[model samples]
Target: MDKMRAMELVLEAKSMKGLTFSEIAEAVDRHTVWTTSALLGQQQMSMTEADAVVDLLGLDMDVARALQAPADKGSLDGPVPTDPLIHRFHEIVQVYGTTLRSVIQEEFGDGLMSSTDFRIDVERIADPAGDRVRVILDGRFEPYRKW
Candidate 1:
C-alpha cells in the first residue's frame, strides 16, 4: 500500500463519495496524487484550502510532517496501535461505528460517518437519575452506495 496514494484516495473519497480519481482531480485543483513539486514549494494550497483539506482528510501532525518532509516510505497496510489508550479509542469507534453506520444507512442510504463537515461538542448534563455525558455530532450526510 502506497501511503501517499492511500492518503490521496482517502481524501478524494471523503470529498466526493463514490467518485473515481478523475472526478476528484477535477474537484480539487491539486493533482490526484501529491507531487514532489508541490512539496518543494512550486505549488501550494491557500490557507483556507489547506485547512479544509486537513480537516477533510483527517490528517494528523505525523502525516503533515511526513507530507512536508521526505522519508523512506513505510507499509501503509500495517497493524495499528495496540496500546491501551489506542485500544480504548478503537473500542469507542468499534462500538459506535456499527450502530452509527446502521442508523445513517437507514436514513441516508450508504455513505460515510462524516467527520468532516461535522461538529462535535461534549458536555455534561445533570440528571436526577445520574450525570450523563452528552456527545453531539453534526454533519452533512453523504451516501456512498445505494441501499
Candidate 2:
C-alpha cells in the first residue's frame, strides 16, 4: 500500500473503531502529535510503532510497511489553506510570524528552530468565554555556522 492509501485506510479504521489519536499514540508508545502525523502520512513510523498501529487499527502488513516509508511533506490543497481550521494557523503566522521571529531571535540569537528535533503539543484551556486552543512548538535551536 502506498503512503496516501495507507493514510486513508488508517483514517478509516480510526473512524470505524472510534479511536482517538491519543489512544493510538499510547498503544504505539509515542506522543499524540507525532503519532497523529505518522498515521496521517506526514511522519514515518518505526517497525514496532507501525506494527502497533496496524494491530490496533486492524490494518494489514502492507499498511504497516507503508507507514515506514518517508513522508511527502506539505501536502496542502493550495498556496493558501481553504479549510477554516487550518487557515487559522496560516492566518496566525501571517499576523504574528515577524513578531515571533523577532522575539525568538532576541532571546536565542541568530538561530532557527530545528524541525528534526521538534516537538509540538496541543492543549485545551478551560474558560467561561469558551475553550481555547494552545499549540506549543518546541524545537532545538540551531545557529548558522560561520565557515
How many steric clashes between backbone atoms does each model show?
2, 0
Q: How much lDDT does candidate 1 score?
A: 0.48
Model 1, position 25: C-alpha lDDT score: 36
Residue 17's C-alpha lDDT in candidate 2? Answer: 96
TM-score of each: 0.37, 0.54
How much lDDT does candidate 2 score?
Answer: 0.81
> lDDT for every model?
0.48, 0.81
Stretches > 4 Å off in candidate 2: 77-147
Query: Which candidate comes out best when scored by lDDT?
Result: 2
- Over 1-147, each residue of candidate 2 has an lDDT whose tens digit, in order, gives 888899889889988998877799899999876777677677789999999999999989999999999876545444668999988888655544543554455458787889999999999999999999999999999887898
